[model samples]
Target: MRSSLLRVGVVAGASALVLATMPASLVSASPVTDPPAVDCQSVLAAPTLDAAFDAAAEAADVPSDLLRAVSYMQSRWEGHDGRVSNDGGYGMFNLKSTTTAVPDGAGKGSTDRSPRRTASQLERAAELTGIPASTVRSDDRANVCAAAALTASYAPDLNASTQPQRWTAAIARFGSADTFERQVLTTLREGRARTTSGGETVTLDGDPTVDVAPPSASDPETDCPPDLGCEWIPAGYEKLVPSDPDSTGNYGNHDKADRTGPGGPKLKYIVIHDTETAYDPTIGLVTDPGYLAWNYTIRSSDGHIANHLDPKDVGWHAGNWYVNAHSIGIEHEGWAGSAGWFTEAMYEQSAKLVRHLAHEHDIPLDRAHIIGHDQVPGVTSGATRNVHWDPGPYWDWEHYFDLVQAPIGQSAKNTSSVKAGDVVEVRGGYADNVNTITGCQQASPGSGDCVPGQGTNFVLAYQSPSLEAPLANDPGWKPNGAAGTTYASDISARIQSGHKLVVAEVRDEWLGVWWAGSLVWVHNPATRPVVLRTTAKTVTTTSTTAAPIFGRAYPEPEAYAPYEIPVQSIAPLEYTLGAGQTYAVSDDDVVTDYYYAQSFDGSIPDDRTDVKGELRYYQLWYAHKQVFVKADDVTLLDPGKRAVVPTRLPKITGEAKVGSALTVSNGRWSREVTDFRYTWLVGGRPVAGATGYTFTPRPADAGERVVAVVSVDDPALHPMLAPSLPTAKIQR
Candidate 1:
């Protein structure tokens, strides 16, 4: 819809002889040539450009053959204008802006501009002709004709060169010439010959070299139709049986597989896919006789599996032939961008299927070999510029890898020890499916919203030019949150021990690692041992002094502590700790004290005003201390002032039934459950039990929440209650 001009030119020397026969006024008019009609039915089609070439050659008084030769040189009449030249010129004729002018009638001027600055023959021709510059740059015909006329203008000089070796040298003067002239010339000559002389043609119809065989009973090479061999299985999966008793039949009707062959048993990569349609329809579509077939379809409900094709035959899944032939496609039912999260059962079953397929086919489970549909490269050289992006940003690579037991995280330790500008590999997951949250409110259970103000942090990383290279980022990223607002942060850096990792980028303290091609940061402190640093730093301490803490002063001291404490030697001083001076204590101490002073309750710290709802009861840990502070507190602890504190162990109540709400309370903080995560427990352990307060109960949980008792970390205060008195419980 945009418009621009095109410039055209011709050398003066050859003008005399060629134009002598034509009227002077006619020479200024645009050239005209017969249009080339091409069949567009096949995958490979010849481009149409006769009218454009003829006009330019005729106007320049150059041989049409020469114009054709130049067209062949530029793009082989492929009509692919987006092609980039070595010098950075884009599109057909590689026109430059210096000589091309926007056409008069073209809507906008100069819509098309080459990456290169130098004008080409096509640009000169567009200028000579009246066509707009943008049209010349984008229109195949205008570009071709303009190129021819410019080439013809140079014909005389080339003819006059006495040195036979200089023939190429003279042709090189044309702006449209390629850097590799010999190759260009050869291609031109071949194309000219093919056009002038009838050549063999390729078709997409039934092949002469191969014959389709009927579905046979015992032969493994027979063809099987869809419905006859497909049977539905649980979880929306279909098990496809080979019509031939031997199970060696080829069932695909397309060109993706070899119909006739000594081709080895069909074993290749497994293609992972997510159905854009709903679950039931996905199964119905794949099972229909006329519809497309894949090896398997996994249901999101419970991860039910179905098979529709045999491993020995190809499935019509990947758009690329090479990928289809060498890969087994498995379609998982669900919209990739839908709001719902991929069910745990579905992910588990998918992983099992993938593992089974990998073992059966000897395929390694790595990024290069196991990729999403979005990662499939273009099939042909020309197709590389146009790629499809699917299975989009919603898939969770970290969780998936964990299921597969794949390595993820930085291998080198001592992230802080690593200096700036140094290369390091940092690995972790970027929650692709996470939604952005801008307001303060309780997130629906299992919404996958990385809870803000709850210590969810993401590291910065960049995409590298080489897809295989590690990601990197500029150092120095610090974020601050506003009152009552929860900002989304990356949680990929929460690397723990036993996770898989590959070196991505090496930089001081920061490693850019790949988790599904998306770079995530891994911070390695320099103080830790290198061997211990390389592996994920799993949180080993169940009760961490560093656990975040938050609370507001009671309007009255008696409002919070209903029970009066008896005087004891071990009791801490009862002085109230200000927001800025909240402390952290060792979690391992057996008799550590907490100090709390009865004060005018209304004199709460200004930072305490930022507290909202349940968040007021928790604290954020920093540098190994349970700091009593509000989220909005601006004062930071001095480097040497941090307190060593005991770990805070989480206490869990018993599991509750599905569809029913459960309550979890630890000291002043409590949360109610309403989602799958809230009703389920993994290995009889509450999902968020490690965090000391939140609990996600599952329907099948084996009753009884495991409870642990540990000391709270605080440096400026002593225990208000006995060490064993402050405990949390999970109950329905």
Candidate 2:
């Protein structure tokens, strides 16, 4: 996991109206009298992405490091074929109103639909670079050139040849927030590199000695990481019914509580969400009484964080109240359906903030504790399908976790060892694991196409082990027994990366996992191994009949009788746990309780109280969402302790290429043991009659990482079966 760096900005300008839409400080520098300096032809003809930035910088007379760092922070130097951010900015440079002013939301309860609109910086970029906006939008080179020209025009204080650190105000002029500027310069100081979507490696060498003034700020009453430089724009917290002087049932935006303070609910999870709208308008809507609220809003362009509801309060963001009651919600400025809308700057900043929150609240840095809003289950059978699936398939959870200092599979200790009934994490590598990702809105039609892998966060499970079988089904996602679709929202067949489940049956490379109360098969090829062996605690149902699954772990009826409130039913969801089926545990012996908080005014009896029940529920990582099973009807199994331990693992060596001989150092155990075995794998499936000490790759194995499961016999130890780390991808 990458260390959560300090809260980790281009102002398109040389425009007028006195920096109307852009932040006043970020881009308020007087425009320079520079000529049309962008050498569009040179930028286009550059041999590499690194050379493209260098060419654009040389043409505009700006530091190449500045251009590269700003680009890195914005799009991770990715063009993505020139996609626009949710805030309507474009390209690797984020050359637009990246620092578009976020509404302060002071008069939060106001029902204002219209947010102040300003002239787009894209127009200013066009004017400064003397290029058509269409060309700037589609061509990566043109976008970089325009960014250089526009940013150079903003820095009238800095000539064509200014020190990298001296460009802070100019970077700030690109966007107003000091955090935005500092982050850009921080990228320069620390440097960064990334492989573009078009498959070109770009690097900006870091000079840790590069110095700049510390960021300035005015963050009052804000609960945020110091590096983030967040602004407190509190979501409305007033009575919705203004006519009723002391209305108990009316409230706007969020509920007030003493969470994360002296006395409050145990903060367990952090739910990630994406705003369907742009950043500024999201603030406008969240402040409105009718619209729901979340804790923070992260901007796509600059990574500026806007703190709304305090950690001490509850935001009505997640549809399930139980989840909201125990979780903190963070919203990013992007649409779930829009591919490449989430920026690297936003991911870095969000990671820092999340790392801070997780550390502060003592929450575990795992998928169970850090979840997407898409994983939030509905409160009942009817409501399951209605839950929002934001921060969708393209969220890059593996990268996000890497930034969060968890790095998904870094938690694996006994990974090279496993047996039946053990738990495993779905881990198809992001850059290579091509997935069939569809969208409810038809936003991504690239499903089932494997040319340039569109990496996703889940693995599709099939009703049978073969590729010809239909995808597995989910009762809550679809009740008609229809198979799962490729829709981003329909997570029926997708076993999200890092999700842990019990192994039901293993037939060669196909693993039959207990998913949604059924045994579904997931292909775990030895090559490009999709699942990581993990020693996680799992639980099985003790009930003779199928155990009922609940979305919420609410208090029993008797627990709420004393208060003037109706009981929150512990409704069983359509999905259930079969008697023999087991699932990985999120938490054991979770308190079965409910919070009674439905009043702005303290008119109701026992308001703002947590109702505790004698009954406890075990939280399980079941299917796409978590489910609560009664602890009394569940038996917690210590799978981790029972796993077969490997003292000295077998090894493999030789050329890992097509038709090249790859040798495995196996078959060295005592000959007395007759149960010992070895197997060679291609694309994770076993090669027929190829269980020898050495194997040769075929033409079909090219570009695929072939592997060998070297099982050694030990008469003293238990049966052990595991695969070696995948060998290098086969070469031609």
Candidate 3:
């Protein structure tokens, strides 16, 4: 194993605290706190969160406002009924066990560092106040008091007379990373107002007098934004087996390959994942040669990033090798299940990183290109069951995308009704999106027994357009044909906030969408809208029979034969697209090719060769994972190619005279062009040989008014005719 993340703080002299091992839930960006098991949102009636902070501050002789600000920065002062975080943290203070944070002889991704372990804030607070650890976990007042004691311990000589500015070092010592300290200081300067889970508004008027320096520039070695606090904690890339080409077995971590140069695979997606383990443990595992590696990991406590692999290299984080070869993987310091809430710092840093990556690689910042680990498709049929689900129900996709400058439903229509064949985007609030999910304990042991209506980003789809109907379960989720359950890991019937789907039906309060080769309904009450109509390009199957979908977009077998490389099969997945049913497509120009990276050191013949093929595939948002279909299998709907009618009628320009030319213009035609056949009429009757723009009137037509009749032929549309006003009588 490699080194853990936490170590004694050199900046915090004589404190000997492990700043990297700080509690994230203690400093969560969102509201934290688990109400008692019965109700997840209930607040304690007695000794309210505010009163506890006040009492704790007085008891520890720390500045009351400073303590409150610290608590506000850690968690929005909410406590889930004492649920433990992934790192075994509990209550509002995010208290945890410091003894188990660091393993002996651990390094910090480099050999220059020494082994160190510092007692956690909860442990130190327990020693100072003589309060039992169990009491601190359950008792909000005690937890607050313990946290205050630890903060005061950092500055022993300080008293009520000390200013908040003087306590900056003390706050710095309490948390690991300069980024976490800056976030706390930012909160102190600007203040904050949040409605707590207990139905009360807490306001911190904030003191502008408090000076807060901007975050330090990101380390030069890491591939991160300058404003972010980044570190270069590289994941292990050593070979465990000699002559083990193809990386089939016995090797740990990622693969090395170029991704940005000419003829190299283009970067397409950025897969988001959550570390099931805590921050320190995540470091240990990623640095271990026996463990899998990703590109980066964001710390929830402060959004401090650890770049594990280069963006151009391949990481084995996503389950599908095809996705792994073409995308960058980022693991968050959180969990797959409902272990705890994510931090604002984590979301902010992750967004900055993603935006930076997207801009650098020319990847779209939409949800389709920026997907979760759950959205990664399996490499083959019957393989999706083992795929992972992280950044689970609690992750706020709507907000995360907003931070990425690509807000969900930003361009959707808020109509009162929708119909079949309409395309829509699923949109909803995140904080109030409390979806009921059972069996949380089964998903992550000790996380909880039930989520009890926590914030979930997705809406469940049903078998029929009715609330009483069963959920729409996919063939991969239920091969035996059972309906999907409201389990934390079960995303079979779920469609997330930004997923664009084709509407198949509309009941009184339900909207049906074509999901996984079937029509499924999701509730869309007017009071709480879940669907926003959008103008998205959709794909329809042309074949009479169902067209098979594929998990990977590999090239034809003949493409590999030219280079003497082994052929990769273009196998079809179980899902298919039937005629007349349309699915939303993400990309129409998906590359149909494969990269043969056969050896760890490029020793094998024809290794590291990228084979491009003539075949093409279109990527579609089919079911849970994005699947591919042959471009020949479905017709891509192009708005530009559709038949269009002119909004304004055609008109004749210039005065009509016996010898003058009268030109007619196709005015205001949109979406299609107009070609007209013109004829000159005399007294409502056609004049022989007068089809030309300029016609010479003879003496026989001097008293008659002439009219120009235009017959228009729009491309792919029926013909129409318009007549010009009667022209001045031909001059004698």
Among all candidates shown, the one with the greatest lDDT: 2
Ranking by lDDT: 2, 3, 1
Backbone clashes, candidate 2: 7
Error of 1 at 244 (Å): 23
Task: Give all candidate RMSDs, comma-separated.
Answer: 29.5, 13.6, 15.7
- Candidate 2's C-alpha runs over 4 A off are 1-36, 97-132, 156-160, 261-263, 411-419, 439-453, 641-732
C-alpha lDDT of all candidate models, in order: 0.37, 0.71, 0.69
Better of 2 and 3 by TM-score: 2
Per-model TM values vs. the true structure: 0.29, 0.77, 0.74
Instruction: Kindly provide the TM-score of model 2 when superposed on the true structure, using C-alpha atoms.
Output: 0.77
User: On residues 1-732, what C-alpha lDDT tens digit does candidate 2 reach at each position?
Assistant: 000110112344333432343333223134533323343556767898889888888777778889888888777887656555655667777666433443332123335545564345666666555566666776788788878776665564454567876776567645444676777888888888788757889998998888856765538777786646888988987777777676457678788777776556667889999887778898998788777888999987777889888787889998998899888999998777665557777898899999999999888898987999988888988788888877877778888999998987786532323346667887765655667755535543222222234567778899888988999998888888899987666788988788887776677778877888777888876655677777677776554356889989898798887888778888888888765567888877575667778778655787777787888888888889877988777677776454221223434444432344444332343222323345666777777987644455454545565665544343222212222221222222
Residue 110 CA error for candidate 3 (Å)?
28
Candidate 1 on 425-493: residue-level lDDT in tens?
233334321223331112222223233222111232333333233333211111121111122222212
lDDT of 2: 0.71
Q: Which structure among the candidates has the greatest TM-score? A: 2
Q: In angstroms, what RMSD does candidate 3 have relative to the true structure? A: 15.7
TM-score leaderboard ranking: 2, 3, 1
Counting clashing residue pairs in each candidate, in order, gives 114, 7, 15
